[model samples]
Structures are given as C-alpha cells and as structure tokens.
Target: MTAAHRKIIHIDMDAFYASVEQLDFPELRNKPLAVGGSEIRGVISAASYEARKFGVRSAMSGKLAIKKCPELIFVKPRFDRYKEVSQQIRAIFLEYTDLVEPLSLDEAFLDVTINKKNLKSATNIAEEIRRKIFETTGLTASAGISVNKFLAKIASDYNKPNGQKTIRPEEIIPFLDALEIKRFFGVGKKTCEKMYHLGIFTGSDLRMKSIDFLEEHFGNSGLHFYQLARGISNSPVVPNRLPKSIGAERTFTENFTSIIPLQDKLKDVCEEVSIRLQKRNLSGKTLTLKIKYSDFTLQTKSTTLPYYISSYDLLLDTALDLLANSDLKTSVRLIGIQISNLNINQKKAEYVQLKFRF
Candidate 1:
C-alpha cells in the first residue's frame, strides 16, 4: 500500500512526571510544581502546567526556575513508579494494535491501519485510546492522527493537555505550508536561524527552494528538509526498537580547573554508564568522552576498541586516557561518556501493510 494510505497516531502524555506527582499527592493538585530538582542546584526534569505559565520549563536550572516562580514546589523523580504507569499505558496500546513504538515513558506512536479492533477511522481509535489511558491510569493524554508519523507527531501538540487533533491527508499540504519553519521536526534553533538568514521562515518558503540549492547549503539534511516540505515522510513505526547507545553525564555547579576533581566526576559517570550497560545486558566497542568547557564550548573524543566491553574499570580507563591526551583549553563545567556500536541480536526488517482505500 502507498504511504498516504497508512494510519498513524502519536500519543503524548501531558507533563508526565509532574502530572504523576500531582495524581499521587493531593496537595500538589492545581499548584505550580516541578519534578527532579532543588532550589539550590540541579536542572528540572519536568515542570507542571501551572509552573510552565510562570516560564518554568524542563532543563532550566533550579535557581532560575525558583526565580521565575518562587512558590514552585520541587519533587524528586520516581522512575520506578513512572515505569509502572508506563506499562499500564502500553497495555492499552497493545489492546488496539501491536504496532506501537514507544518514544519514551510518556509518548508513543501507533500504526493502527490493521488494528486488532479493525477500526477504520484513525481519529476514533485515537480518542478511544486516550479515554482508555485516562480510565486505566487516571492520567490525561493528547493524540495526533495523520497519514504518517511526522504529520501525526506535529498534530499531537496542536491541542495539548487531554486533547487530540487529526490532520487528514487532504489537509497535509496547506497545513504544512502555513506551519512555521521552527515547528518542523529536526529543525533546531541553529538550523532555524540559518534558514531565517536564508529567507526561509515557513514551509512554503522551504518548498520553494530546489533540492540542489538546499543540498548546496544544508548538505545531507538539505534533502530531508526538501522532502518534509513536500509532506513526504515514509518512515514507519517499528515496535521493539533497539537503542543505539547508552550513556551518562554530570554537570558541576562550579567549573573545575583541576584534573583531580574532573577525574572524580568522570569516574562517577563511567560507573553509571557501566551499570546501565549491564542492566540492558549490552556492550559496545566505540567509547566517546564529551567535555563542555566553562565558555559553553563542547569537545568530544572517541576511540573504538577491538572488542566490546561493559566493565567500569575498562570504561574509566578509556575515559581517563581520552581526557589525559586531550588539550584542556578552559575549565570544564560538564563531562559525559557514551558507548555505541552495540552487540545485540538483529531482527529481520518488518513493515506494516496498509489497507488501501478507494
């Protein structure tokens, strides 16, 4: 079947972490709350809608978030609880279709073209799923239904906080044409700025550029933009997707000038990565060390070993070696370690067969 005939739905939970906190704590309801941070330091992992109204957002420093909303309450993250609730939600998706691709604990994509219930209207299936999620978990979710994942993902955010939107195939062109360039998936702040400098501010502006011109300016990603501008995304939703990497990082409250403190931090990060790799029963040959300087400049060094390793001793040795040989131009504010090129069983490629309509 053609790509345009596929039924895709993107479901995203509203302020997942914060919402879960509020649901469990009666007093937190309707109050500005933040999850996973402290007033003195650290970054917020999630912010409640009430906190968002005060300009508090995820990844914002705790000090800045408190400054924006002094009354904001912070709670520690409970990953185990979140995982339990996520499992409940996933069961609901499986009830309708097995072609569910979980993006995270709070969001997923479902290809319901040939669902278990044999539902024809993707929009109705989305609404039903949302209702089931709320009924089962007492959490609100929003959904976007469209012909493909890209359009559905964008539509999911249109009506947030327990609402859903459906972008019909016929509306894809005009909807994308008027959409802001910044709203397009994969277009980051830097890319948006570059596009602005090139006088491309909207989908229509992006569509007006030729493939050759886009490639000349944006390289490989240029072709991606060109295709998205024409509503041409063919990527399918694959279930049980394997992770490409496992990593961990730490940001220091104060930048460190001495190698001693940096080494301690690197040891802690390496241990965390090792634990994660062991938890997943995975290992990789390629190891990368990331350093962010006080000036916000970033540097990365990577080395690929002949054999896979997931031990803390090996990871720390490789990380320390990379750091020792690197040029330290400035104080380091953050450091990270990652292992990629994983050793995992590869599965045969599978595609969802869409039922074509007249």
Candidate 2:
C-alpha cells in the first residue's frame, strides 16, 4: 500500500505528571500545579495548564517557576504511579492493534490501518482511544491522525490538551507550507538559526532551496529537509524497540585530576547502571568506560567478560581496571560506564517480538 493509504495516530497525554498529581490530590485540579523537585537546584518536570498560563514550563528551575506563578503548588514526581498508568494505557492500545510504538510513558504512535476491530477510519480509532484512556485513567489525551508518523506527531500538537486533529492526505502540502521552519522536526535552536540566515524561515521558503544548496549547507540531513519540505517521510512505526545497551554518565561541575576521584565517580555511575539493569532484568558481558577530558577530548576503553555481570561492584571494578590501564593525560570532565552485548533470554526476546507484531 502507498504511504497515503496508511493510517497513523499520535497520542500525547496533557501535562502528564502534573495532571496525575492533580487527579490524585483533587484540590490541585484546575489549579497551578507542578511536578518536580522543590529544592533550590530542583527543576520542573511538568507544569499544569493553569501554571503554563503564567509562563511556567517544564525544565525551568523550581525557584523560577514559583516566582512566575506564586500559587504554583509543587509535587514530587511519582514515577512508579506514572509507570502503572503507562502500562494501563499501553494495554488499551493493545486492545486495538499491536502497532503501538510508545515514545515515552505518556505518548505513543499507533498504526490502526489494520486494527483488530477492523476499523476503517484512523480518526475514529483515535477518538475511541482517547475516550478509553479518559474512562480508564481519568486523564485527557490529545491525538493527531495522518498518513505517516512525522505529520501525525506534528498534527498531535496542533490541537492539544484534550483535543484531536487530523491531516488528510490532501491537506499535507498546504499544512506543511504554512508551518514555520522551527516547527519541523529536528530543527533545534542552532539549526533554526542556520535556516533563518539561509532565508529558509518557513516550509515554503525551505521548498525553494535546491537539493544541492541544502546538501552543501546541511550535509546529509539536507536530504531529510528536502523531503520534509515536500511533506514526505516514510519512517515506520516500530514497537517494543529494546535497548542494545544500558549505561549511565555524569558530567562533573569540577573536573577531576586524580584517579581516586575518578574511581569514586565511576562507582556512582556504575551503581546507577546497576539499578537500571536490575529494573530491566538485564545483564551484559562487555563493559566500556567512557572518558571526556577537561579539554573536551573523548576516549573509551572496553573489555568483554566471559559471563554477564549486573552487580554494581563488578561493573565498578571492571570500569576502574579499564581506566587504570588507560593513559591518564588530562583532567576528566565527564565519566560514564556502559554494558553492551546484553544477555536477552529466548523467552524475553520472543515476548518482545510477539508484543510488537501486528
């Protein structure tokens, strides 16, 4: 089938963390609420719609958020509860089709072209999913429907906070041309600035640039830009994509010069990785130590063990051994440890495949 014949839907929960807090607390509903750390160094993980009206936003400092909205009530994040809710929502998606690709705990892409219920309209499926999510979880989800993932993701944001938008195949070209360049996916601050200087401020301006001009300026990504400007993206909706490796890293506020300090930091990083491995019930045979020098130079050392190891002590020791053998030429700005060649059992692998298959 052609891309235009496919049916895709992107669903995003509105103010997920903050909304959960409000739902549980009752009194916080319709009030300015934020879920995050309340310490001086704490950051806002999510802000309720009421708080957003006052210029409060996620990733802003807690202090700044409070200053912006004095009535903002801060609540600690409940990741466990969030995970439970995520699973509940995932189960709802599964009831329709196995083409559910979760982007995070609160958002996912669903290809309902050939759903279990044999739904003909993706828009109808999106509406039904939103209704089910609200009925099951007491939270609102905004949805976007389109022929492909990119347009669906963008359309999902068009009407948000308990809303839905659909971009028909006939509407793709006009919709894209009216969009700002910054609204295109992967156009970060730096890239937006570059595009602005290159006279590509909107999708219309972007379409005017020849492939050669874009390639000369943006390199390989120019091809993506060229296609996106013409409202063409064929990326598939992949579900249950597992991690190839598990790792953790930390950047030091103060660069470490001594091996002792570096070893201490490595222990912390390894512990973090161990926690993740345990959470995912995973282990690996290869251990890699990544180092970033004070001068921003990067180095990595890796060694493969005979058996998989998930213990914190073993990973720390292996990482330290690798670090010790490597030449210490400069102070370290960042340190990380990763475990690759993961030991995935046949049962788990089969489970992942079955869960993802349509």
Best by TM-score: 1
- Report lDDT (Cα) of residue 1, candidate 2: 68
In order of appearance, the predictions have TM-scores of: 0.91, 0.80
What residue pairs are clashing in model 1? none
Over 68-149, each residue of candidate 2 has an lDDT whose tens digit, in order, gives 8888888888999999999999999999999889988999999898999988998999999999999999999999999999
Question: Please, what are the lDDT tens digits per residue for candidate 1 over residues 80-165?
Answer: 99999999999999999999999999999999999999889999999999999999989999999999999999999999989999
Model 1 compared with the native: what TM-score?
0.91
Candidate 2, residue 44: Cα displacement in angstroms equals 1.9
Stretches of candidate 2 above 4 Å error? 248-269, 278-309, 318-358
